[model samples]
Target: MGSAWKQLPEELTGPARSLAEELRTLKDAAGLSLSELATRTHYSRASWERWLNGKRVITEQALDALIGAVECDGPALRALWQQAVAGPSGAEAGAQDTAAEADADADAPRVAGVQDTAEPVEVLPAGEPEPATAWWRRPAPLLACAAVVALVLVLVGLRATRHDDPSTPVADPGTSSAPVTVPAKPVSSDPTCQAMGCAHKNPKDTGCGKDARTLQSDVIGKVVIYLRYSQKCQAVWAAINEGQPQDYATITSSTGESEQALIHYGYDNYSLMLSAADPAVTFQVCGHQPEGNLCIAPMSDPAGMVASTPIPVGPASPPPGVGGTASPTADATASPSAAPTAVS
Candidate 1:
């Protein structure tokens, strides 16, 4: 069945309209309902509706989540989103026009007619002579004149009280006139987890994925393995792409701590994080497939969290009798049988 998408607002045009249309297309291609999309992404259903309908601007995070969910080309969608955001939004332009019209109405000169609600002025007989009034009877005019005179006298007194003569020396206060220095507030840090607290935790959930980098990456047969590290969380994890259902990857740290995860859903999956606060510590990431196993030895870099020696990229398999090795703290051992050559 075709998607039953609501009509976008008439004001939405140009890049914004293109983005909204593309998002709707992706949603339909994924065969995900609005509620299902909401469940899979971080945004609420209502928020998704607003963004998809062009009623609100889509954030970068929300766009990334949507692309990831639908498994679409991230760079293409990101470029479209950037184009839409770089210019003034359609909603904002409409709002600006409305405000300008309201301001013009407010600043407009009103004529004395039906629109005017002020009390009408009294009209005496046409040619009749006006009666002279005493100053006391015209209290409003007299009071206004008296107020203006009083203001003038106060200004004169203030001017006379000031020491205008340059020859006169004023008393100096002992206090320093230098500006007071206020210490700046420290900037708030990101990543909710750190060090041991990040151990065994999902890197994405702990906000470590924002700054994560691949220390080592290698392709074995049809599957690719990545040794991912997060400097902010001080942790490392393993990720596998183009994996099978039973495919799993294990990441072992120098301290003998290891974490492993099996692919259960899509072709892409990652293992839980393991704390690696010391840069001197080495790590070994291994990916296991039905045919054989592949491992990369990640050398540590003292200046940064990057690995000094990255595994060569390309399709390669481990030597015979070389399977997934166990960490020092674990009791598992390698398989003695020779692993078969991987099929490209």
Candidate 2:
């Protein structure tokens, strides 16, 4: 993937082509394969490849991730990406909208018997006058007094309750009046979603957890992904190993609700932190083309999924979604099968 590569489309002139060229150059300088890039960045490798190949425009998120990956924080690159995304298509869409509006106006119905019976609305009194006080600024001392009394009653009730319970220590009258401190989310350092820890707890806990269940992969395509769920965590996450640039994968629930994640040019591997998608609704994973064709081709349907009991990970499995793998894009790019060209 060295200097020589497939040429960009001739139609991709102007900002769009400039952006694509710059992205490729930046990725090369970073010295990371597409797969490695995807694992490190939020955007997937497949998505990035499409942008670099001039198949589609990249998103601002993609540019941001690319900037981070290359360790270069430049405003010019962002501007270029913006221009590319807002290319001819944007202007065309605007023109189309304008034409539609004009056509609607021309076709509007008119009746000869119609009469203009409209009335003018009154304007605000313009005479000079003193402005009234704002609602919050009004004199409300009695309201404040009532609120303080209510607070005191609540605190006193608690104090009396504690006093009645000999085992409970009554809060001292001199203690800080600030609200009592309470831990926000019950967090645990252990990644394992144990029954006790995950009970009534959020799926994404403090640390990376063990794989509670592994999904079977039947369809193999440009991208190969595996799903794993932790009953304790009550969550499902995926680790994708194989994929070309611009490939995207989506997880849809039994109810057709879905969450979509994208792959960028150098992105190879990815793992999703399951949260929104509910386990009660059976979920399916589908891979999509970076440009389109989402879920059009999928490895397997989620219908096969069943109630999985807690199966703690043994010594056989290491990382979360099977073992993460790499892509071959970089290897081909380094030697640059053809001529070296400048994007900027």
Candidate 3:
């Protein structure tokens, strides 16, 4: 009976067909019968006929067997086999088949029918599976959520701190802490000082002048300094309240001096005067002044003469005779005979 492989179409053309043609050419060139080729390749005659006739796809092992039977170049035939399996048709496939045949002519060995056992096929490695992930597991989305949560936590912490802590104590420009129970240092009395409008005849008098005077007498001869009118005053006051060392300048000025005098004295309200000659000079700062001036009032020595020496600049020390022995007190004995008695 004719071979069942004969059913292959005459027009069947591709890498597979090209491989079959090369096998046939190899057999003819070697002048070998099917039985002889099969014996040399260690394959059955039927298997050889079927493979060469293109009845089944040729495997690399089978191609290797055929190369031995025909004494053909193994590398050339193996290369052509690889191309044939890669694609069914293409110019490259044809070229590869042609090159294989040319190489086979040069190196093939003659063979008579012979049979040899086939080698066992090796198992292929299994394919790896893809890793699983959830929709929210994407790196970008996770990072964005983390950032938002951090921001929210920060905002919440800040809000809670603001509410729980005390309100920032407001220190007036030239004044100490905001006036809570006591009013700020007196600036000017009501312009209308008629008894009906303001009880004090001198509108400039602070209502607590007596109290201030009493405090001054007790601390006399100690360096008494006050901050002038400026943002710097607020800073100094804050520092003082904290019990930190602070340096204050003592300014001495008369009532009738020009506004420029206040500026030179580093005071906002120049209405207040400092008695450089007072055993202990008193600074009645205008806690409030439209022009933002710091008024200085230095009670004169009992004799009513201004002291020629400037007040020293340093941290405020405890009053003499109160905490410890007094530093040589300014001539407190200077008589106040000509000094103004009324604070106003």
Candidate 4:
């Protein structure tokens, strides 16, 4: 068999001729018969013969496989492929000759045209192309988005203002108004009477004492008790001892009227009926005994009190005429007293 390595014709025209020559060279270098090369490359023997004989166009995949099998330099083969792709076909020899002549005589600068071979021109850099911006950095689009947000805020503000009462005027900082004067209601002596009458009053009065006075007492304190059906109420009480150290006290159902009560004895007769279903569970607050005896007062259910109603819980007014404005009197009138404690 003749060596597949044939010199490439100088007049080789298009890619078909170049590919055929390259394939022939690859087969020659592999030192394999056409059938053997075909088996290795998976191309049929007839197909390989036709491709190497310049009778048919060859695919780049086939050329690549042949190059890989032969271990040939790929860059050189690629350059040859490019040249063949740019060349005119054998049938267009006259046109190719004319193009060659024109290209050779191109001393003057030529206008841009499809076939202009101005040394394979590169795309212009568009005079330092503008840098790409982040999505948020675009001024027009960003401003539009900000305007939309501002519009939404303005609409929400307008809706809010519409719901507000228009008749209420904004208070002026410097304007002075007349002071609110809440008329003083006469303090009842009933609380004082109960404290003195209760017989279970601890001799030491530690159990039932002056701390059990009515809401009329000038004491300021809050007592919170957590109670369970079976468990004893845990009373956490705190009060200012401004006047004589007011002793702390608590009276429960367990403490009979005769027992010495700490704060107030009047609250002992009634038990707090805290309903598990009540939105706000009601607790009882009592007064100190020395000031007032067992006073049954229904306190706001602090467990879940929503602070909708204001209940005052202390002295009627500042002791007679104590100087600078007295504290507002607490509203301590609501009592759930069914069986009032009898003064002994």
Q: Which numbered prediction scores highest in lDDT against the true structure?
A: 1
Q: What tens digits encode model 3's per-residue C-alpha lDDT throughout 265-314? A: 11111123222222333333222223232233443232222123322222
Query: What is candidate 1's lDDT per residue for 187-306, written digit by digit as tens?
Result: 233988997899988765676655555555565665666666676788877766445557878888878889875655324457788877876788888989887988886655412634
Which is better, 1 or 2, measured by lDDT?
1
Best by TM-score: 1
Q: 212, model 1: CA deviation in Å? A: 0.8
* TM-score ranking, high to low: 1, 2, 3, 4
As for model 1, its CA RMSD to the true structure in angstroms is 30.0
Question: What number of clashing residue pairs does each candidate have, in the order they appear?
Answer: 0, 27, 27, 36
lDDT of model 1 at residue 140?
Answer: 42
Query: Which lDDT value does model 3 have at 273?
Result: 26
Backbone clashes in model 1, listed as residue pairs: none
Candidate 1 TM-score over all chains jointly: 0.39
Better structure of 1 and 3 per TM-score: 1
User: TM-score of every model?
Assistant: 0.39, 0.35, 0.24, 0.23
Per-model lDDT: 0.51, 0.39, 0.31, 0.31
Residue 238, model 1: Cα distance from true site in angstroms = 0.4
Residue 222 of model 1 has an lDDT of: 53
lDDT by residue for model 4 (1-344), tens: 12623333333433435455555545543456654554344333433543564433343434544554554445556545444333333223211123333344244321112122232211112244222211112124554455445434543443354336353232233755422222222322222212223322221112121112122112222211111110011111211111111333333332222122231211112222222223233333343523442333444333232133232332111121222111223222211111012100
